[model samples]
Target chain A: MSLFKNDSDFKMDVLREVGNIGAGNAATALSTLLNKPVDMAVPTVSLLPFEAIAERVGGSEAVVIAIFLRVDGDAPGNMFFIINREPARRILQGLLGFDAAENDNYSELELSALSEIGNILAGSYLTSLADFTGLHMSPTVPSLAVDMAGAILSYGLLQFGTMGDDALLIDTTFLEGQQEAEGHFFLIPDPESFDKLFRALGVPL
Target chain B: MTEGTLIKVGMADLNIADGGAMLRTTGLGSCVGLTLYDPHLKLGGMAHIMLPSSDIAREGQLNIAKYADTAVPELLQRMISKGAVTGRLLAKMAGGAQMFAFMGGTDTMRIGPRNVEATKLALERFEIPLVSEDTGGNYGRTVELNSLTGVFSIRSVQHGVKEI
Candidate 1:
């Protein structure tokens, strides 16, 4: 008996291909921002059952930054850009070169800069994905959070709902000289969204 | 030096110290830290609330210091017991931030915001004026208040060491 009876393997392959392209694009954008040599490892992509997401990234007391994007279609799909808080702060500090001794808190200027950084990263990843898979999507304004993993994933799952039943997660690490950042790229699709993704990838369900 | 009587507020104990009483709590995250003081009476109190509402308390019947709603009232009662009359009390608040980033947007889980909101409401219900506050940001704050001097300070690391 075959483990995957349908076109699931095909879909997974397309996701990995798109993830590789997205990771490359993200690396370029980050390198430009840091004005240094930046390397992003080829993402490790996998298909995750919706129920396992909480267990995979839940309950850790960490801050998170998330960016949501809506893919264009008759029934739109959603993509997420998620990062842990410590990395978010460190990334901002590295990108801005702000001195810690002089400032004891995130100035409004720093918040703006971090938001812009999120926009660039999310935009580049989606743009590359679109180019590779022939799909188009636009993102909402990024939001910041300081909470447990369970809360963050729960919120995303609720908004996107059972759409993530057939989800793909791409995990990658970004390195800029000695500073490093970790990120998660989640591709979620409902039945309708899955149709759009299949159409874009030229795969039949 | 009075050895500064250390009031070890367990999970839900609202402690009020007046004129030579010092109230303190250790290791706080994603909880609201509230300080109410009366400059005239040289009395003050602090409550460390773990959640926003007593209704959600896994342990029924609020202990005051555990949840925001119950804790605020309990703090007030204790302050009153310590001779902090309602009209004379002045409030200064701090904490209530999503200390961990993985929690996501404020709209999703509002413990931090709710705690801040509940504290404000409780103060308003008693007609106490909130003088100054540092709340609703993405950082954990550790605070210390001196009962004798009525001076309070909060220290946290966001980008660096910050005192408010």
Candidate 2:
């Protein structure tokens, strides 16, 4: 009775719309923080079988920064924020105005700042998503990492779910003046979370 | 005839020389390659940072040269010690690419872009103008910087060879 059955395209379209709202919120937050107008591209969202995630992002040799979150309440779900490491660091540096010759070591202060930045961006984005979908949810504390393709992929796969289930990933870019940053938003729901989301979205039980 | 001197920079070693050193690296993917040259002192330095921060690196491996967060400072300090003045220095950077395209979803693996951004920030903080850079592609780049002339070359799978 649910049109959701075998409707991958429909699912992708719904997720893209959700992503657009989320990115808009993130851009607004970023603009306020930097005191500059921030323009974000419309998000590109895809729903892939978990098995394909590793292959999709792992083809290149670049650093990855991933933030994981758990969304709960009426529609329980899991979410992740992924970005290329260079963009993450650039965003941090741009925000802080730190120089190249300054101490390259990241003190707890700097790391904390970075984490807070990620939290703000991801939080605003996901909150807007929940509003659009008529669900109530909040994000978890942000996490950061700098690692190879294999290490990042393995970590995400292990932490989220097995390879068979479908994973939703949303890609977007943040642009302000000459600075640009790109990131991915991934949602992989566990069995319970998946059920909650379906119920909240008014999908047939 | 000028002798081409080879300086092999280990994890945290900052190599700086005046008028005659050739700094080189074999395999560079996500790590950063930074070159700073002081015109007045005729001195130059290069550092290869493997990660973003030394604080997060493994124990017993807490060296300034091992991470971008530490290597940039150490490199500048070493250059200063070698009679290179900070105000007269100019910086050039390369490397930091997602060599493989498969790891798309996770944020933890995006270190290449981070390294480049971190390095740029460090340079800017030091008031060092970034004269040139080649960063953030989907391919690995091997770079060679000539300390004496401040000229560098980047060789990658996609872009054959170009001077920066």
Against the hidden reference, what TM-scores do the models get? 0.49, 0.47
Q: Which ten residues in a row have the lowest lDDT in candidate 1 chain A?
A: A157-166
True contacts kept of 2: 0.00
Estimate, for each residue in A1-205, the C-alpha lDDT of model 2 and write its tens digit.
Answer: 1224655575656656666788789888877876778787777765554435644544323445556555546655555666655655666677778741133345566666766777888889878877776777776555554443333443333222222234455666666656645555555544345445555666444
Query: What is the C-alpha local distance difference test score of each model?
Result: 0.60, 0.63
Q: How many clashes in candidate 1?
A: 12
User: What's every prediction's RMSD, in angstroms?
Assistant: 10.7, 16.6
Report the lDDT tens digits of candidate 1 across residue range A1-205: 1223487777767656766787678778877886767776656656554335534543222444555454444434455666655666666768777642133255677666766776787788778776766766665566544334433443343322212232445556565566545566665543345566667777776
* CAPRI classification of candidate 2: incorrect
List model 2 lDDT by residue over B1-164, tens digit each: 13487776533346776667678653466667888888776677888766665545433335566567677778889988888888898898887765434323344357678778888877777888999998887555667777667788877654678998
Q: After superposition, how far is residue B163 of candidate 2 from its true place, in Å?
A: 36
